[model samples]
Target: MSLLVEMRGIEKRFPGVHALRSVRFDLKPGEVHALMGENGAGKSTLMKILSGNYQRDGGEIFFEGKPVAPDSPRAATDLGIGIIHQELSLMNDLTAAQNVFIGREPRKSFGRLDEPALNRQTADIFSSMNLKLDPKAQVDTLTIAKQQMVEIAKALSYKSRVLIMDEPTAALNDAEIAELFVIIRKLRSEGVGIIYISHKMDEIKRIADRVTVMRDGEYVDTVDAESTPLSRIISMMVGREVSEKPLDVPDTRGNEVALEVRNLKRGREIRDVSFTVRRGEILGFAGLMGAGRTEVARAVFGADPRDDGEILVHGKPVSIHSPSDAVRSGIGYLSEDRKRFGLATGMNVRANIALASLDRFTSKAGVLDERGMRETANNYIDQLGIRTPSDTQEVRLLSGGNQQKVVVAKWLLRDCDILFFDEPTRGIDVGAKSEIYKLLEELAAQGRAIIVISSELPEVMRLSHRIAVMCEGRLTGILPGGAETTQEQIMELATQRESAMAPVGEVA
Candidate 1:
């Protein structure tokens, strides 16, 4: 195998920060190179420079042993380099074929869209990858796993010699990940170079041939994937050794019930699920990708209409018709997709921090208390350790972990008693994750009822005071927190297909 792409002494700078500093990276043909780093460690920055989204201040880029510069994404694509971002970028209203061939569509003699030809080409691509998807199907109608497949297919359609995948398995299930690996292996056999950026350690061990670690915007080390221990790789990525212990939270066994749900039902996804969370407790909801953990959170928070259910606050029934109702009842929900449903990206941090409790910053005459809001925002910025230059910084300018802290501060300012954290640490770094975990523990200690919905089994096992397993919208069972419960036990309950509504003895 030969070097397909190389970057030496790469440097990138912004207004007040050096985003990347003397970063060195290389990719070889037919080999999967893993880029491991914590959030904001310059993993995305380096890739963005390579993809022509950002221009490096100083660097040398070599492709196929020839020095080259790609001024735009089009130029990069023309050079047989394709990148699939962590976020899905497909237009929801467009058909699969349309999204796949968006800018490079086939044209007929009259310069009109060659609809049949486009669909046929897309079908061929899907067939080659053994992916079952209809070219004419609406992109919005597909599941997240299917949408990811479409992204991969789009990259492959460019006949890319070098492909970059960022967090490809972030939203995929085990089965979907297996399928993606098959495709990746096929590409490798065809001599395609692959650059994989992800925080998942197990995946790096399973699929990568070489591992490169980045820390604090600089290249740390690179080693053979098979020979490197996960701990050593983690140490290099964070610049320090990290303990693998689960987060610690106080026991909530004797606490009073804070929130309760009975016979909850939502469209096909959530069945007659029921659970109780006590004051000063972090109740974790664990399941597979489509296991209805998020759906249950949505229904409880009034983001979605429930078919039938009784929600109780402090043992008193409450009617929750919308998000406002839930908020008024002292409940707050943080969505899994932070960009879509959680924060206003264009807004400044101070404005977003006060978003949930704007009424508190209003006077009797309906005048906004700008000073008070600013003070509150400043307090949260200090307390949450949000890495922002100032409260006036745009939310999008902050890193993934900082943005998540902003969302948490939003709910904290609202004085919400019951909080639903959906994938709170999804794209966060190891350091930030520890901070968030500590924050959650402190919140629980303050007598708040928290429910965490996460797809990562280890996370659920670590921070939960009690674990509730959901499978296909049904609550399988609950287990006490601590060392007694294993990930496999939680998975068993997560995969349980029996209806929770059935009599205890009658269910599977």
Candidate 2:
């Protein structure tokens, strides 16, 4: 196999960080190379260089055995390279066909709009990838899975010989993942080299031909995916031994219920989803993406309007029409999309920490007590081990893990007894994930009711005193916490969407 792409001695630098250093990466024809790294490990930085999103400070890139430098994303695309970003980039109102051919559209003889030609071309690409989606369907109308398919279609339309997918299946379900794998295999057979970046070990094992591990912006080693064990791969990525510790669920058999939901319904996503969390207990919500887990959390936290439902906190029924009402009722929700929904990126650490409980740091004259806010922020910074130069540093400047801690501090300061963590560790590194898990355990130990919504089966199995699985828009079943409950059992319940017609609190 000949090398299709080569990056030698790649180096990238920011104001205070040497993002990448002396990194070497290569891709061969007809191979799926997996990139493994911890968060902030420079995998993305290296990819950005390849896709022409960032210029390397020092590096030599060779394409097809010839030295070449791409100055921009367009230049890379013109050279048969296409990259699908970690974040979905699509116009919500535009149709799938339009998004697929946004910059490069087919024109008629007179340069008039050629709607039929565009749809037909997109339909052909969809057929080639074994995908079922109407090209005329609006992007917002499609599920996350279908939107991902559109991105893939758009990449293929560029006549790309080398394709890059960054965490493509992070939000996809098992069925959708299988469909994606089929398309990947088809592309593999066509001799298109693929660069797959993901954190899921099972995915890399199943799809990748070779695995390249990086740590702190430097290449560690490359190993054969088939022969290498998952433990070994993880060890290489983190440069340390990793443990698979099962979560410790504390006793709460007779504890009072902190939160109760009855007959909750919101659109078609959540239907009569009812559950209760005991004080000092960690209740895990387990399901695939789009399984109504987050929907239930949003409804409970009053982030979304509910068509019909009843919420009871501490045995007292409360009407929560908005997030302010939920917060006043001692409930807080940490959204899965931390950057978008949880944090005010433009604000400093102290301001973000004080956001939820501004009254505590406000004077009677409506003036902010900067001294009190700074003191509280500093306390949280020390207690939570938030990595920052000072309390006034911008929240966006911190890592994902530290930013998450800020959110946790916010809810803690607000005196929220019942907390909802939706995909709490998504986009965080492995080490940071353990820290967050420990923090959740500590919060539960302190008698705070915690509801954890996670798509990762291992996380659900490792953290919950009891597990609730949802499919489509209904709670399927709840399992007692222990080593006895396996990932397979939870997945079985997660895929049971047909049985969702039954009302909540009913055993399937």
Q: TM-scores of all models?
A: 0.95, 0.93
After superposing candidate 2, which stretches have Cα over 4 Å from the reference?
Answer: 364-367, 495-508
How far out, in Å, is residue 489 in model 2?
3.6
Clashing pairs in 2: none
Candidate 2 lDDT, 264-365, residue by residue in tens:
999889977788898999999998777888889888888889999899999999999889999999999999899899999999999999999998888899
RMSD of each: 2.4, 2.6
The TM-score leader among the candidates is: 1
lDDT of each: 0.88, 0.89
Give the RMSD in angstroms, all C-alphas superposed, for model 1: 2.4
Error of 2 at 288 (Å): 4.0
Candidate 1, poorest ten consecutive residues by summed lDDT? 499-508
